[model samples]
Target: MTSSFLQGKKGLVIGIANDQSIAYGCAKAFRQQGAELAVTYLNEKARPHVQPLAEELGAEIFAPCNVSHPGELEGVFEAIEARWGKLDFLLHSIAFCPMDDLHGRVVDSSAEGFKTAMDVSCHSFIRMAKLAEPLMAEGGSLLAVSYYGAEKVVSHYNVMGPVKAALETTGRYLAAELGPQQIRVNILSPGPIMTRAASGIGHFDELMHHAEEHTPVRHLADINDVGHAAAFLASDAARSISATTFYIDGGYHAISG
Candidate 1:
């Protein structure tokens, strides 16, 4: 709640679509903590949804970017350079999988779908970090969202589970490579939360219910829970922590039930 923690900080939040988005929550929380914000929308369809949110947040920079496109990624960094000169934080909350692949068994996942999932979910983070590293002259924090499915299979999570596993592995590698620069790379794995993307997964309601029932907190995590965790990890408070994946699943990952 106190803005002093992030006073004078600047950040870029990629993948905000609407208020319900985890990225949106992180953006809002970062702003409340006094961080200047910039946002990226994937395409024209999402622009309308993200623009108003950016406006509300008083974001100085709003750009259209597709992580799959190297040109777009370069443009985003260029825009950030033009506006802020340097970046203190980056939030990567982007992932994708074909709707058909999301409902099928992992064995049924097509090679193309699997590749697309890995490109979007896993590789993009690495690409983003590579691009952001130079701009983080004084060192910075990079945060990405993963899921419990990365380590344990969740029904219908399908190709995304593998993508997340790869993402976690990438995070560790990046942390090691970037630690000498004082740049931190970490993944936050949150339990099921009702987001636009979650709706596409089969039997999402049942998954939510199961998570809540089994978690020690007896409740599923909300966007704010994720947002706050991200803020802390992105802040000086977590300066010593790196090469780790923090589970924000309300202790669900530990429960056998």
Candidate 2:
């Protein structure tokens, strides 16, 4: 059932590429709970896919944001500042790595590829937190997507494992840094699910099946599951929670096969 858990809240959602994106799931759930939204598309090529989804969610601010671009990321926040004046939450759900580095072992990955992966997948969250902080004057939540690979060695998760590890640690530190202001920073780690981003991982199908089979629940979660968890974290319900990794992996992270 729909509830007004986030009624009157205003936030931004970055990293939605298409309908199957985790950011889309979060935006959908947040809207169902009555949160006003601002969304971003990567570029012109992605605009067609994301704009419709933003329209469907009634997002008041829809703009192009490529974090790698000089001012694109800043521009989105600037628009949010102009439109909303204040912010309640923000979700960062984008990650990228070149195919070669992703398919290669961490030891063999090139310096440039590793650096680019870290910059996009991990450091971008830090940049978002910095940009989102001032707008969250009334105290708000900041969330980023993480994975079990951050904590353990999952086959085919090579370079990203370390990248996510950095992200998780970054969230912890941000949580502590922002807590005094009543701003919360957290990471949401979900089990293997086929996302446009995940398509780059080598042997992804094998990874997904292994997760389902070994997971205590014997199943995996979908985008909606991650979305709901994200909504809860963004809501007043989790006011005291900060600097933590909230897992929506259906017992997969707890078991060993």
User: Whose lDDT is greatest here?
Assistant: 2
**Weakest 10 consecutive residues of candidate 2 by summed lDDT:** 1-10
Q: Give the range where candidate 1 is weakest over 10 consecutive residues by summed lDDT.
A: 1-10
Instruction: Return the lDDT, model 1, position 185.
Output: 95
Number of clashing pairs per prediction, in order: 0, 0
Check candidate 2 and list the clashing pairs. Answer: none
lDDT (Cα, 0-100) at 110 in candidate 1:
91
In order, the Cα lDDT scores of the candidates are: 0.90, 0.93
Off by over 4 Å in 2: 1-3
User: lDDT at 204 for candidate 2?
Assistant: 94
Best by TM-score: 2
Quote model 2's TM-score.
0.98
lDDT of 2 at 49: 96
